[model samples]
Target: MARIKDVAAQAGVSVATVSRVLNDNPSVTEETRNRVHDAMAALNYRPNAVARSLRTEATRTLGLIIGDILNPFFSELARAVEDEAREAGYTVIMGNADERPDQQDHYVRTLMEQRVDGLLICPTAEVTPLVEEVSLGERPLVFLDRTLSGVEVPSVRADGSTAIAELVAHLRGLGHRRIAFVSGPSTLSTGRERTEAFLRAAAEHGLEVPEEYVRVGDFRAGSGRRITAELLDLAEPPQAIFLGDNLMTLGALDEVRERGLDIPGDVALASFDDVPWFNHINPRITAISQPTAELGRRAVRLILDALHGRPTDSVVLPATLVVRESCGETGPGKEDGS
Candidate 1:
């Protein structure tokens, strides 16, 4: 396919010149406009609808709906999507759901109003019906990270069960029998799957996980801190904790430090999702590192494939467990570190 750069090169003008001529902005010289038009004809450059939509309807743009743009994970994913979309000559419209169903629904409706060519969505926990409705719409849509039940759309996600099991096994190897599993709300598939995997992993190790030891909170630093404090005050505090998400991990770490308790020495910690700051912090946190970049790239590809009428299926990428100093008193063995 001939790109804008090709048209610009052929016209011996800058990309901006080509854009101006294509939009008929009345700001370009007649000679320059003719050169661009000749180049477009020679290269068979198809003007995007948005460039001509100043007086018409279609907007050659894509909408990206993320659960929480504040989180590094979602931000990175959004960045990747934006980069890919721009390279394909499409602009991206981003909307933050704040993990709220109503906000998500509003964003979807707003994006539709903007006449986006397609959508990439990370659905909120409570908006399954909304997701299904969008998927059934004329615009092509692809789900990212977590998927909605009964929604037959291409999706990209990490292997939550395997990642959780690996994290739990690593904790068990460090001699942590009584482990606390702190998680986000079980309403979402990611949270629910991770929590269930924690329980199943505990059973595999013949460890009894008491109900009090398992606490669910919002996927936030404050929730992590609050829940970690509650776990520590239990009659028999857990020797180790498997935290659900990155924000929750931050909260738990803050709580542990505030209490003057040493990491791995007093209460071991492990979490899902390895964010950028994980390594720089004191007593680096051990984490299950999902292929975030791969997930983002694959999600974009899936959407593009659907747009091109290329059939694709839901994809679950593998996760890597990065063993750091946060596991137990003895620390991770050489073979386990990644």
Candidate 2:
């Protein structure tokens, strides 16, 4: 499909010029407008949701940009947001950033051009300038799951420090001394925060977490598998390996299965995000459960409240540790998976 850039090229103008024309901006010369229209006709270009809400001063539509559609956590969060928006009689347009900062910026700009009543984003760590602009702009903007320090936007995020501490304590009690971690990329706030929380918890428990014990993954199954393999190859491998995200846990499990390693019996496993499937896995995986659906619901409420001239504040929800057999709790009559 042809994009805005193609229209700009055919019209011999910048993409911004095409956007202005589409929005019917009064600043554009009549000649330029004619050229843009001619280009559109020649190329059969179709404009996306553009400026329909300008006159009414409201689109009754909310834009939601997510980090990754493939992540089950984000998927559940999106569903909650959509449900809340639907109940409020507002439509939601979703954009998947796929964890790319540039892609995120693109969606933000496009949604603005579409004149969405508000925006909800699970921002990347890069902190694109456009996001800052939206926060400062007249429109209502809210950050979902992640927010930057200086952005000044209301956010709904989950705190997992307590859960991480509890998980560390559980592992220590299970007689697991050396525990390694597979973390997500540093380009996201969740990735950094979870790892920091784990480190703090490890230190509090008197367990040393060296640089080698921390491997960075891209929050994908492939990275989880590769990092787990690298960690397991160490001369003195860790007694347990904790995955920083749900998808990473899937990858780690694949590696363990291919190598014929038993859960908890070989190397104990844990995860940051708890999904439904985790419970079904043999020797159910121990995990930290985040308020994902609540985050989404709270984010929508914040945006709606702001748009309605009501007060709004950033919401921080808690995560809890869910212990299962994957980490192998030791007790009488237990199979000793730990």
The lDDT values for all models are: 0.81, 0.86
Candidate 1 lDDT over 178-212, as tens digits, reads 99998878888888988888899889889899999
TM-score of 1: 0.80
State every prediction's TM-score relative to the real structure.
0.80, 0.82
Candidate 2: the clashing residue pairs are none
User: lDDT tens string, model 2, 166-185?
Assistant: 88999999999999988887
TM-score, structure 2 vs. true: 0.82
Error of 1 at 150 (Å): 2.4
Deviating ranges (above 4 Å) for candidate 1: 1-58, 128-130, 329-338
